[model samples]
Target: MSALDAATAFAEGLFEELRVNTTDAPGITRAAYGAGEEFAHARVRAAGRELDLDEATDAAGNLYLTLAGTTPQLPGWILGSHMDSVPHGGNYDGAAGVLAGLAVVHALRQEGRRPERNLTVMVIRAEESTWFPVSYLGSRAAFGGLPREALEARRADSGLTLREHMERLGLDPEAVARGKAFLDPARIHGFIEVHIEQGPVLERAGVPLGLVTGIAGSFRYRHGRCLGAYGHSGAVPRAYRQDAVLGFAHLVAALETSWDGLEREGLGATITFGEVATDPVQHAFSKVPGEVGFCLDVRSESEGVLERLHAELMAHADGIAQRRGVRFEFGARTGSTPAILDPALRGELAQAAGRAGLRAIEMPSGAGHDTATFAAQGVPASLIFVRNQHGSHNPLEAMRMEDFAAAVRLLLAFLAGRPA
Candidate 1:
C-alpha cells in the first residue's frame, strides 16, 4: 500500500477510536491518571502491537512504542505528544499528533522501510493540568524535572497527596525520583510533535500548516489571603469594615495593570486570573473572617523577560497587600520554561511541507506544551500545527479533514524521502 493509503486507513481508525473511547459529555474528563486515560493507554499499546512495534511503560506512566531500524548502532528518533485532553477539549489537540505518529509507524511497516535510527512514538500522560498541581507531569518526570518536594504536595480539591495518588495509580513516586522513568539522553536523536494550532492565526492567514518557531514558557503565581471580618451588608459601617472582597479586587487590578505595562513594552506577556474564591456568604448577618485567593498566569517567549515580569508582579503584589491592609501570601505555582525550538529541525520541517505542496507558515505557540519539556531535555524538537476552527476548546471544536490529511502527508515527506 502507498504511504497515503496507509495514512488514510490509520487516521480513519484513529478518529473512530477517539470518538468511541472518549466520554460523551460536553467536556473531556480524562484527568491525569484517571480511568479514561488508562483506557486510552491500552488502545495506544494495541495500535503499536498491530504495527509490530515493541511497547514499554515508564514509572511516570509514559508509554513508548519502538520500531527498530536497520542500523542498530544509530540513536533513535522520537515522535511524541501528550494524549490527555483539557476539560471540554476538542478531539484534535493532543490526539491528532498521537494518531499521526501511529500512521507514520504503520506506513513505514507497510513499505518495509527501515530508518537509519530507531523510531519511537510516545504518549505522555498529564499534559493537562487536571490532577497534578503542575502540568506536563509525565514529560517532567521523563526529563528529571520534578522537584523532590513536589511528590509530597497535596491537591487542594482532593485530600490525597501527590505521592498517594501516584501510588493509587500504581506508580512508585520514589522510583520516578531515581530516574526510573528518565529517557536515555544519548539515545534520542530528535523529537517532533504535531498538534492543532489551538489558535486562529494559521486559519486566518489561510495557511494549511504551521512550522512552530517556539513554544512560550509560563509563570504561574497564586496570591491572596485569609483576611478580616465579613460583616452584614447593610449593618456594617463602611469605615470600620475589613472587606476581603475589596482586598481581592485590588490585587486583581494590580495584576491587570502590570500586564498592561508589559504589553506596552512589546513583551508579549499575558496574565490571567483563572480562579478566585472567598469564604462565608456576603449575605450572612454574622461577621466571619473570609479567605480570598486568585491565580496569575504570566507567559512570554523569553526567559529573562518572564523573570523580570515575575519580579515586578511580586513587588506589585506586596504593594497591593500593604495598601489594602491585608496579610497576603504569594506562592510560586510553576516557574518559567523559556521558548526553545531546534533551528535545523524547524528548517527541515518547513522544507518537508514545501515538498509536499502544502502552504506552511512560521509561528510561535502561546501555550506551553510537552514539546517545551522535550526541548528542555536537549532534544531537537519541532512542532506542526494543523488548522483549527475559531481556536475553541469546547466539544464542538472542529478542524477540516483535509487539513489533517495535509499534515499527515507533510509528516510522511519529513520522515521518508518522498514528496507527499
Candidate 2:
C-alpha cells in the first residue's frame, strides 16, 4: 500500500480502538488525570511498542515515543499534541495529532528510513484546561513554565488538588515542582503540532490545511458578582430600587455594543459572557434579586486590543453600577499571553505544502494549544490546522479523512526534509 493509504488505515484503526474509551452515549468524556485519559495513554504506548519505538515519560506525566536517528549529537525534531479531551467531546480534537505522528513513524519504519536527527512523538496530558483552571498542564510542567501556585489548584469536578491528582496517577508532583525536564531545548531543533481547526476558517476558505500565524491571548473574569438591596417587587419603585440584576443586564448589553464597535473599527476582538447566575436561595418571582454573578471572557491576537477592550468594559461597568445603585465586585482577572509562531518554520511548511501540490492558508488560532506553551519558551514552534467543518470542544466536530490525509502528507514531507 502507498504511504497515504497506510496512514489512513492506521488512523481508522486507532480511532476504532479509542472509541472504547468514550461514553456509551453520543460523545467522549476522556477527562485529564482520569481513567479515560489513562486508557488513551495506554493505547499510544501499546502502539509505540508495536512499532519498535522507544518509550518514556517525564516527571510531569508527558509520554514520549521516539524514533532514533542517525546523528545522536545533534538536536532533533519534536512532533506533538495532547491526548485528553473535553467532556462529551468529539473523536479528533487532540487524538488526531498524536495519531498522525504515529502514522508518520509507522510509514517511515516500513520504508526503512532513519531520520538524520531524532524524531520524537510527544503525547502531552491535560491540554484541554477544562478539568482544571490551569492550561497546558503537562506541556508547561515539562518546559518549566508552570507556576508554583498551579500545583495547589483544585480540579473543578473532583476538587482534588493538582498534586493530589498527580499522585493518584502515579506521578511525583514534587519532581515536577522541582522543574524536571526530559526534553532539552538545546537538543530540540523545533516543535510542530497538527490539530483540527476548532473553527470554520479553513472550511470557509475552501482549503485543506492552515499554517497558523499566532495563538490569541485570553482574559477572563471568572467570579464577578453584583450586590444590591432585596426589596418587595410590588412595593419598591424603580427610582428607589437597587436592582443588581438590572445592573448586570445593562452591563452585558453595553459591553457587547462596545465589542461590536471595536470590531467595526478593525480592532479584531471577541467578548463572551459565558455564565450568569442569581443567588439561588434569595431569588424568587416576587422579590427583587439582591445578588448576581457572571463570567466574562475576552480574547484577541493583539495585547493592545485586549487592553483597550478591558478598559472599555470597566468604564461601561462603572457607569452602570452608579446608575443602578448597585456595587460591582469583579474577581481577579486571569489570562494567557499571545504567542506568534516561528516564521522560519512557517516558511518551511509553506514550501513543503507547495512541493506536495497543496494550498495552505495562513491564519490565527482563537483557541489555545500546546504549541503556544512551546513557543512561549522560545522554541521554534509551528502549527498545522486540518480543515474542520464543525467547531470543536463538542461532539459535532467534523473533519474529512481526506483532509487528515493531506495534513499527514505535509507533516511527513516537512519532517523528512532538512531543516531550514
For candidate 1, the per-residue lDDT at 72 reads: 62
Query: Which parts of model 1 have CA positions greater than 4 angstroms off?
Result: 155-158, 226-228, 280-290, 390-393, 418-420
Instruction: Note the Cα lDDT for every prediction shown.
Output: 0.76, 0.87
lDDT of 2 by residue, 1-420 (tens): 996778778887887788766663578877888877888899999999998888999877899999998885778888889888888888889888899888888888877888888888999998887787777788999886677788887877789998998999889788888877766778888999999999988999999999999999888888899899999999999999999999899988998898888878887777888889999988999999999999888888899888888898889888988899998888878787888999999999999999888899999899889998889888899999999998998788888988988988898788777553
Q: Which candidate number has the best TM-score? A: 2
Model 1 lDDT tens row, 331-403: 6567547757999889988888888888999999988788888787788888889899867456866777778
Q: Residue 191 error for model 2, in Å?
A: 0.5
In model 1, the clashing pairs are 27-88, 28-88
Candidate 1 Cα deviation (angstroms), residue 163: 3.1
Regions of model 2 farther than 4 Å from truth: none
TM-scores of the candidates in the order shown: 0.91, 0.96
Question: How high is the lDDT of residue 403 in model 2?
Answer: 91
lDDT winner among the candidates?
2
- lDDT for 29 in candidate 1 is 47
Ten residues in a row with the worst lDDT in model 1? 280-289
